[model samples]
Each structure stands twice: as C-alpha cells, then as structure tokens.
Target: MTQTVPQTTAGADDIQEIVERILSAAALPPIVQAGHPALRQRAAEFDGQLSRDQLDRLIGIMRQVMHEAPGVGLAAPQLGIPLQLAVLEDQFDVDPEAAALRNRSPLEFLAILNPRYAPLGTGRASFYEGCLSLNGLQAVVARPESVLLEYLTPDGAAEQREFVGWQARIVQHETDHLNGVLYIDRAQLRSLSSNAEYAAHWAEAGISKAREGLGFDAGPAGISLD
Candidate 1:
C-alpha cells in the first residue's frame, strides 16, 4: 500500500532518471500519486486509434489495478494516462441507515469515456469522500445531489444518463480528474482526517456529528479543529 508522491515536478531529465530507477516495473502501471503532472493537466478525449481489442485490454488492466486499490472509482489520470475514462461500482448491502444517510447504494460496474455532466436539480449534499490517488485521507466535499450526463461506453456508443445521490458524487469525482480537479481542491479542509480515524470515530456519528466534531462548520472565529 506504500507509494511515493514526488515532492517536486519532474523535468524531461528527471523523468528519465525516474524511469531508470523503476525500470523493473514497466509492466504493472503504478497509480501516480498527487503532484504528478498528469493528475494536474486536463485529460484529452480518447484517441480512437487503439483498436477495440487494445482498448479492451487497456480497460481490463485498469479494472484489475482499480480493484487492487480497493477503491469504488478510478480515473485514467490516476494511472498517468491523460484520457477521459473512469470505472466505478458499489454494493448496496452495506448498513442500510449508513448507506441511505451517505447516499450510497449498489451500482453495477460502469466504464465512462469522454464524460460530461450538468446539474439535475437544485439539490446539494455534503459527505466525506476519498480518492485513490490521494490515499489514506478523507474529507467532506459538497456537490450537487444529482446530474444529467453524456458519455461513451467502451464501444464508443454515445449515451445519456441521470444519476442521483452517491452515484452522482462518484461520477463528479472521476470526471473532475479528467478536468484536473481533485476532491481536496473542493473539500472542506477542516473535515480532513485519516481514513482510519474516520472509520473509528466518525462513520457512525452521522454527518452532522462528524461535521461538528471535525470542525467542518467552524468559521474563522469559531472552535479550533485541534
């Protein structure tokens, strides 16, 4: 589970040095942590050059890596590939109240290419969120509760879909990567906490309790987070 986030941006020479250092790991693509150039630069629409078979293989590998991270969703930029693609799924069998409270539910694995989204309604919600690239951390991110989206399937068939609750949040999160935005960029910094701390102390407390305890609503003149 250990990974490194390069402290400084790399130059062409630095990239060569990095490549030489990890030459043995050419096959298994590493999930690039935050601070890498790819995670910051907006991704491009997928070039249709890769044949369907090649695209399938690429998607397969990405799926395997995503599952290994044990994350519900992942984007192409996370793997250092600047393409508009992402995959995600969730199980509805988690605690009912918890799932309902957090707007999470079962969802079949889905892949999205060249995705775009617009608000579905005026509803907004806030819940703690995490990212694979920004591992070990969680924070409260406020986003629209639902969205209308357009994206391509793996086969390049265009489609429109509507999503609500946690599903919408996941979609927004992944698509944000394609636009060079991380949850942290929109997160309530006061709510930041280690995943372990969140699970141990905040998970069952409910969002309001969690927010109060984490100083999420504390203004500049309010209670100290520490």
Candidate 2:
C-alpha cells in the first residue's frame, strides 16, 4: 500500500499567536516553535495554491521575527512548520569585495518554496554560526561558500540561481532547516566559542577558513556570531 500524507490547513489565529510569541520572546524560539500540530508533525506538499492572503501573512510574520531576532534567514521549520519554505534577508551593508563575490545586488529578502540545492564543489569553509532556535549559543560550522539552488516562488514560478559568499552560506543554513538539520549538528567543538572569542580569533586570523576552501576571501565583515 502507498503511504499517504494528510492534507493540512493553515489557520490565521493560530499562526498569528505563534508569530506574536516569537516577536515578544527575549530570544528566538526553539526549533519547531509554533504552528499547528500538523505543521510541526509533517508538512504537506505546496500544491501551488497558496492564497495571496496566506503568503502575505507568512511574509509579515517571518519579517517581524527576523527583525526582532536579527537573523539573516528563517525557514518554515523554524516556526514549527515542515513546509519547504523559507525567507532570507541580507541586512549587512555591502563591501566592494563582498559584492564582487556575490555578483548580484544585495537582496533585501527572498521567499523560497520547495527548494533544491547543490554544492558548487566539494570544498567547505569554516565559519562561526548561530541560530535563533538554539538561543545564546554559537559554533564554527563548515559550509560551502557557493551553491546552485532551484526553488519555487510564492507565486509558483520556478526560480534557479547560483549564490556565492554570504548569500550562499545563508541559503545553505536555511535549507538545512528544511531537512531537519541545525548548524550545531555540524559544528566543531573547539571552534564553538563565545561570540567575542570567535570575533577575536577571526580578526587575528584575518580570513575565514570557510571562504578559503571555496576559493574565495573572507566575507565582507565576516559572519556575525551574535
């Protein structure tokens, strides 16, 4: 017999309450913080039928949570939904070197649906990483500095793009959420340290090992450990 996944509904009040809690929390919520049990249990396929109202609300709530927590990206799973969705914002001001590496205008925010990602190469770089879910902890995790990704837009349009530098890292980080993985799961113990310590170490080193493995230089300002 073929297994079948249950269809689920996205409720307004329920999701709104979670969003509010996330905004008010002193820190980012734990992994799978809010949303319906179905949302947390397992997400259904997108079916290319999200209403504008639904998309708007999800975007608004995600934006608020990201602003409050000051993270570069968030995934539906972070909000307790297993959907193949995410939002990303590059808030840092661009440095010339960073911009050249990305080869795209700085993006304010992006909404992704049903994403597929592939590393550009086998090489990896080490950067201190943190998550809203883990709260007050950071670690040095290896990630690809560049990747090629394909995903759907909120409107169901197919989108394919290559990301480099910080953008690539951000995409990889969020995509991990879709697969039930966190940065900490891939972190190195010695590399995991306080934000200040990580900063001092990176400054002393003057270049991120993460970028070097990818054949690039350090990120514009380096990855924020906060």
TM-score, each model? 0.81, 0.67
Task: Report each candidate's C-alpha RMSD, comma-separated, in the order given.
Answer: 7.3, 8.2
* C-alpha local distance difference test of each model: 0.74, 0.63
- In model 2, the Cα lDDT at residue 202 comes to 45
Error of 1 at 10 (Å): 15
Per residue, candidate 1 scores C-alpha lDDT tens digits across 120-211 of 87888887788889889988887889999899999879999999998999898898788777888777888888989988888772568787
Candidate 1 similarity to native, TM-score: 0.81
lDDT of 2 by residue, 1-226 (tens): 2223333455555544555555566764554432335332334345533456666667677777787778888887677754667899976665676456444255678998878788898766655677777666676666776799998888779999998866887888787666555676566654555666555544322235534432443222222221
Write out the backbone clash pairs for model 1.
none
Model 2 ranges with Cα > 4 A deviation? 1-44, 48-50, 94-105, 196-226
What are the runs in model 1 whose C-alpha is more than 4 Å off? 1-27, 218-226
lDDT of 1 at 142: 79
Each candidate's clash count: 0, 2
